[model samples]
Target: MNAIRQRIDTEVIPTPGPNPKNPLQARHLDHRLVHDLIARPEILGRLRALVGNDLVVWASYFFTKEPGGKEIPWHQDANYWPIEPPLNLSVWMAIDEVTTENSCVRIIPGSHRRVVPHVPARDGVAFGQEADPAYVDEDAAVDMVLRPGQFFLFNERLLHQSHRNTSSRRRMGLSARYIPPFVALLDQDAPPLFPDHACVVVSGDDTFGLNRTTNPPPRTA
Candidate 1:
């Protein structure tokens, strides 16, 4: 993984601007780094081991924090993902070193089982907060510090948040969301996949579409 990280960093250039999208930004849909990571046989095998053979690349994004970036408010990934059954996994790969000193994702283990009502995001907030008292347990949250190249896989419903990058160095990470091919989009009105239109291989030669049909119909009771 270290080699992979180094290759991506050396080959890709960072974008400019306060929140310039990272190298694998939404606009660079067919970027080589994106293709290398997603289409890698090892990654695909690992994903299949967990979610079975039929899987879909639901979404992908990059997060980078420079000095004084605002805190990513506490929230669950499921809150933003409009998918039914909530059976999805996220692979958070650290492009730059991550530690509590800078910016690292903090997760509440086993909190994935708790279904809390979604609270709308306040002005300038990246994610919504959990208002339910029962779901807010400060002690349970754990900070995940990863060395460049290391990655963590967690359930989409896991309660998590990231703090501001107080340190001088920048922190960067790439996040990829995956789901079984059977899962369905809960919100038909949700925005199109990042990059608007691009050919992303979710399964075999099938390119990802704005509104693609699922293999096994969404399990709606």
Candidate 2:
């Protein structure tokens, strides 16, 4: 991670949040490996049970929260996402050991049952999107602490957040957002996050024909 952080942290005052901005566009980062890892029978097979067989990884990012980093307020992934039906699911793979003090992901139980209203987040937070902090049942928030290589998949609409890392160790999570083929990318009119956002088909086929996913470059010498 030190190498990755050094390689991608090109911005001034980079604090382990979204440096180099979006991970989806990072050349040094290997998106193919991410696709292959989630496509395996053990992972993709289980995802099919929750979503459908026709899957496409439309978005991916690395959420790096350093010790004493910014607060990740309670919010739903679907709030910012433009996908319809909100069927897209997210899988967050832990790249470092996670704990409560380190600000591991926490979720409000049963919060996925409905869409909670979201408003602009306070300044300095990543992405500037958040749900009402008071709306969440803090007592019911379940901490998803994990170690390196462990991951958790959940509904995109699930209410979740992370605290300011009070521990010395930094935390990182790789998130891949998957959705069925029928889900349309409503943000074509909006500015592209990356230079080119291509649909990476992780499982089944893209019969919908609405994707322009560019495959990762072939391995080099």
Candidate 3:
């Protein structure tokens, strides 16, 4: 966890920018450390039990919330995703001691049952769009407080969000998205996903051959 956090700290500066600035999106593509962590046998074993053996890791992100960072509005992962079947399981691993004060992720219980409507996000939020408040049940929301090395899994359509970092301590977490080979990535050369993007097959065989694939990056010095 320390090594991963060091890599994220070296790769990204918590600054406002177009994309991949503070959150450091998609590092698993080229970062050997991140790629190895996501491909660990223990993690893959759990993922296989939930979804299947064939898993393609198409996306990864470092959610680094510094002091006074903006809130990530309540939203579903599928809202901005571009994949057929829209199936994915996100493994959010904590790199820091996550707490409510530092804006640990929160999720509504059983929110993945149906897709919720979205609206333009209010001011001081991270994402442009957010789940409609009418559909969000705050009373049922639960905070996912975690220590370093801990992780949680959630479905693609699960409604989740994090509040602004009110504490002086910084909060950091990494998310790796896994999907079956049958789910096709609609576009490879696009925002969030760069040109020549290749998804890594983390487990089982890629029998479907629906998306571009690549091998794990070489270990960095």
Candidate 4:
């Protein structure tokens, strides 16, 4: 994690968006972190058990919340990704101790099974007020508090969001997405800004290259 942080600190600049200054947004740090994390046999073994061997990282994002950071509304991660079949998984690691006072992620249990319609993420943050009426059950949502060095791995389709950071200290986290290599992107024309080599699957034989391979035939309506 230190190596990854150093890489981001040196190579990339904090991407500015609708949010205030100090809200860190860095992509492609996965290559550095994966290289470091995969070296750990125990971590690799655990990832292999979950994602199998032939996996590729789909996307990654780092969120660093400055004091008084904004709130992230409830939503599902699959709503942002362009992959088909919605089989991706996310690993969210808390770089700093996170609590309800800060910005701990809240998730709706068993919400992964439901396919929610995509609502435009507010100001590029993957959260919004609108929700799929089909899956509105108040009892299912629960808060997830993570300590520094702790992480949560869950299906990307799970309904989750982070509340505002009311604390004085900064809240930092890394969110990485993984997927099977065979899963093709639904939007071939629109590719992510960062390079794809950042992804590394701990298990499976499949490998990813710079080549852009389209699905044999696009999904039909």
Candidate 5:
């Protein structure tokens, strides 16, 4: 965990601003510590139980909200991803003690039942797109406060967002997105995915051969 924090402090938080090539956006691609976290035995076991045995980690993002950071408007992850089936299970793990004051992720209960329409986000928000305000039930939103090392799972279509950081503390969390190998990922140079993106097969076999696959990085001393 300390190593993860160090990397983010040195490589991610120091960046001038958000970019497609930002290290925090996909640290798992080159960092062994981040890669191993997504493939941890306990995490993979639970993921396998939910999605299936043959799991492919297609994306991993580090969500870091420093004090006074802007809010991420409500939006479904499916709105931004490019996959054949658009099926995904997001594992969001807290690297710091996340709380409502620090803008912990908030989700609308049962919002994954339908895909909501999105529009260009207004200025000052963290994302470029946001779910239509008419469809968001802010009154029913639930805050996901978590302790360090704790994680929660949500579907790709779930309506989730976070408020601007009001407290002095910074909130940092890692989200590892998993999908079955059968779900092909399209567009290599897209916003979320880079040109040479490689998916990691954390469990079972990826017989589908739909997307590029690679072995996990070696453990660092």
Candidate 6:
């Protein structure tokens, strides 16, 4: 924990930003940890329970929200995803102690049951898009405060968002997306939203041959 914390604190966080995309994507391909976590047997088994026995790691990302970082607007991960019927799920692994004061993730219960409309965000706030706060019972939204090394799984279409890092500590999380091979990504013929990424079959075979991938990017920068 100390080593990775120091790495993130020194190497990843404090990166020149005010960037529009999530901080995680910056190191998405640069780190071997991304692939290692996805290939984890326990993680793969759990993902199989949802999307079926066969699965592919479609995407992975890191979230390192520093103090004073902006709040992520209420939104669904599926809103930007290209998957059909949205069978995707994510495992958010905590790298640091997270809490409500430091902008931990929050989700609306049962919100995964449907897809809601999202509008473009204003003033570069949040994830560049947002769902109406009035759309859900904000009071009922659960705070996913986590201790270091803890993690949680959620559906991609689930209503979730995080707040600003008002507290003094840095908050970090790594998300790995999993889906069955039958599910396809939309808009592949055009410029893709997330580039420099490849999917890998962590467990079973990709019978549909729907994705292309490399044997994990080099770990050393």
Top-lDDT structure, candidate number: 5
Per residue, candidate 5 scores C-alpha lDDT tens digits across 1-221 of: 76777766775456532234575776676667778877888798898899789999988888988999999999999998889898999999999899999999999989999999999999999999999999999999999999888898999999999999999998999999999999998885676787767888889999899998877766761
Q: lDDT tens string, model 6, 71-181?
A: 888898888777776778888888888899888899988998878888877675757778866576688799999887678889887888888889998888877787888
For residues 86-130, write the lDDT of model 1, one tens digit per residue: 788778888788999887999888888877776755666555465
lDDT of each: 0.64, 0.70, 0.86, 0.60, 0.86, 0.73
Q: How many steric overlaps does candidate 4 have?
A: 3
For 1-221, candidate 4 gives per-residue lDDT tens digits of 55555654454434432122322432333233333432245544556788676666545566777778887767776676677767877778776778888878888888888777755445644355435645657567777788765777788778887777879977877776667776666653444423322344445544644324221111120
Clashes of each: 0, 2, 0, 3, 0, 1
Give stretches of model 5 more than 4 Å off.
2-20
lDDT of 6 at 71: 86
**Residue 172's lDDT in candidate 3:** 84
Q: TM-score for all predictions?
A: 0.75, 0.82, 0.92, 0.72, 0.92, 0.84
TM-score of 1: 0.75
**Residue pairs in collision within model 3:** none
lDDT of 6: 0.73
Q: Which residue pairs show collisions in model 1?
A: none
C-alpha lDDT of candidate 2 relative to the true structure: 0.70
How well does candidate 6 match the true structure in TM-score terms? 0.84
The TM-score measured for candidate 5 stands at 0.92
Give the Å shift of residue 83 in candidate 3: 0.6
Instruction: Candidate 2: give the clashing pairs.
Output: 198-213, 199-213
Better candidate by lDDT, 2 or 6: 6
Q: Could you list the CA RMSD of all candidates, in the order they appear?
A: 7.2, 4.4, 2.8, 7.9, 2.6, 3.6
Weakest lDDT window of 10 consecutive positions for candidate 4? 212-221
Give the range where candidate 1 is weakest over 10 consecutive residues by summed lDDT: 212-221
Kindly give the stretch of ten consecutive residues in candidate 6 with the minimal lDDT sum.
Answer: 187-196
Q: Give per-residue lDDT, candidate 1, residue 51.
A: 70
Badly placed stretches (over 4 Å) of model 6 are 7-23, 26-30, 122-124, 188-196, 218-221
